[model samples]
Target: MSLLNGLPAHVLLVHVVVVLVPLTALVLVICALWPQGARRLGPALPVLALVTLASVPLTTGAGEWLERHVADDPLVRRHAELGDGMLPWALGLFVLAAGVWLISRRTPAAQAGARSGAVLRVAAAVLSVVVAAGAVVEVYRIGDSGAKAAWHDAYSKTATRPGDGD
Candidate 1:
C-alpha cells in the first residue's frame, strides 16, 4: 500500500478521504434534520458513514508511509499530526449516523408516541449537526496543512517554463 502506479499511495487515498468524509457528514446532517431525507436516505447513511470511516485509516496509513519516505519538514510533520486526528472524528460521525438511521427506522407501533419520537429525532439531529460541523472543520484544517506541506516551495510568484531565459 506504499505505492500505486509508481506514485505514493497517499496521493491517491487522500482523495477518497477528502471527498467521502464531508459528503458523509453532509448526508448525516440532512438525514438528521429532515424526516423526508431520513426516510429516503436512512438505510444508506450507515453504509456511507462506514465507507467514509474506513477510508480515513487507509489514507493516514499511506500518508505515514509517504512521510517516512520523504524528507522531514515541519509543515509535513504538522500535516501528519493533524491527519492522525481524523480517525476519531470519522468514528464519531459514523456512530452518530448509525444512531440517526436507527432512530429514523423505528416503526410506529414500536414507539411510545409521536412526541417521544420527535424528541429523540430532534436530539439526534442537534448532536448530528454538531458532530458534522466539527468533522468538516477538521477536514478543512488537515487539507489546508497538507496543501501547505505539498506546495510551500513548489513554485514562485511568476510562472516560468523549464528553460525560460536559462
Candidate 2:
C-alpha cells in the first residue's frame, strides 16, 4: 500500500478520492432534489457512496505513509490534517446516500401516504445539500494544501524556453 508501480501510492489513490468524492456528492444532490433523478439514479447511489467512502481510508493511509517518508514541513502537516478530516465527511455522505436510497425504495404499501415519509425525505434532501456542499469545500481545501505542499517551491517564478541558457 505504500507504493504503486515504484511511485508513492498516495499519488495514485488520491486521484480516486479526488474524483469520486465530488462525483458522488453531485449525484447525491441530484438524487435528493429531483424525484425523477432519484428514481433513475437512486439505485446506484449507495454503491457509489460506499466506493467513495472506501477510497478515503486508502488515500489517507497511503498519504500517512508518504508523510512519514517526506521531510517535515508545515504545508505537508496542514495537508495531512485536512486529509484526515475527509473521513467524517465521506462517512456522512454515504449514510445520507444510503438513507435516501432506502427511502426511495419504500413500496406504496409501506409508505401508506404517511406524513412521516414525506417529512423524512425533506429532511434527507436538506441534509444532502449541506453535506454535499461541505464535502466539496473540504476537498478543495485539501487539494489546495496538497498542491502547495508538493509544488510551492519546486517551480521558478519565470519560465525559460529550451536552449535559453543565461
Candidate 3:
C-alpha cells in the first residue's frame, strides 16, 4: 500500500488540535477549578490558553479558503459561521491576557490591582464561558451534520430504489 494518504495535513491538524485540544482544555479549565478538590489539575492553563488563542487565526484563515472551494451547503455554511465567530473571542482573550500581564508587572505585591478583582475576573470568565458554550453548540451541530451527511448515500439509494424513479 502507498504510505501517503490523500488527506491534507492542514485538515488533519485542524481536526486534532483545533477541535479536540481546545475543547479538552476548556473542559479541563472547569475541572481544574472544581470547588471540592485541590486546584493542581490546571498547570497548563497558560499553555492551553495560548494554543487556543493562536489557533484562532490559523483556523479562520484556512476556513476562508475552504469556504471558497468546498461545495456550498447549508450545513457547511452554518459550520463556517460558527467557526468564524471563534476568532474574535479567542483574540480578545489573548489581548486581555497581554494587558493583564503588562499591568501586573507594574502593580504592587499586596494587591495585583482591580483587574484581577471580581469585575474583570467575572468579565473574562463570562467571555470564555460564552466561547466554550458556543463551541459546545457547534460540536452538536457538526455532529448532526455528520449524521445527515452519512445518510446522503442511503438517501440517494432509497430515492433510486424499487421502481421509485418510474
Candidate 4:
C-alpha cells in the first residue's frame, strides 16, 4: 500500500518510463530548435524516438506484471486503469518527439515541423501538467480505496471464522 510495497523491483523500470519518457521528449523538443546543437548532443532523434517508444511497452508490461500480484480491489484496479489511460498520453508524446526529431533534421521540412513543434511544445506542457495532476489524484484515490478494501477484507475475514461472531 506504500511506495515500497506498491512499487516493486519487477516494475521499477516502469516508474522510470513514467518519468523518463516525457523527459526525453521534452529534451528533444528543446533540442529540436537547434538541429546542429541537437546533432552534437547524441545519437539523434531516431534513437531518442525509439527510447521514448520503448517506454510505452515497458510501462505497460511492468504494470501488468505488478497488477497480477496486487489484489483486484477497485482502488488498485483504478490505479492500473490510470496507467492504461495514460497509454495515449505516452503515445502522443512519442509521436511529438518523433516529429521534433524529423523537423530538426529535415531542413526543407523544418518550417512545417517548426509550426508543429510550436503546437507540440504547448501540448506537451499542457499534458505534462495534466498528467502530473492526474497521477497525484490517482495515487490519493487508489491509496484511500486500498485502505478501505484492506480494512473490509480484514473485517470480513475476522467475522467469518467458525469461532468468530460479528
Clashes of each: 0, 0, 0, 0
**After superposition, candidate 1 runs with Cα above 4 Å error:** 108-114, 162-166
User: What TM-score fits each model?
Assistant: 0.91, 0.93, 0.52, 0.53
Question: Cα lDDT of all candidates, in order?
Answer: 0.91, 0.92, 0.50, 0.55
Error of 3 at 81 (Å): 3.0
State how far residue 126 of model 1 sits from its true place (Å).
0.7
Using lDDT as the measure, which candidate wins? 2
| Poorly placed runs, candidate 3 (over 4 Å) | 1-5, 17-43, 92-119, 142-166
Best by TM-score: 2
Cα lDDT tens digits for candidate 2, 6-79: 99999999999999999989999989887567667856999999999999999999999999999999999999
Query: In what order do the candidates fall by TM-score, top score first?
Result: 2, 1, 4, 3
lDDT over C-alpha atoms for residue 130 of model 4: 56
Clashing pairs in 2: none
Between candidates 3 and 4, name the one with more favorable lDDT: 4
Task: In model 2, state the lDDT of residue 32.
Answer: 83
Query: RMSD, model 2, all Cα superposed?
Result: 2.5
Model 4 regions more than 4 Å off: 1-10, 32-39, 108-166
Local error of candidate 3 at 145, Å? 4.2
* Comparing 1 and 4 on lDDT, the stronger one: 1
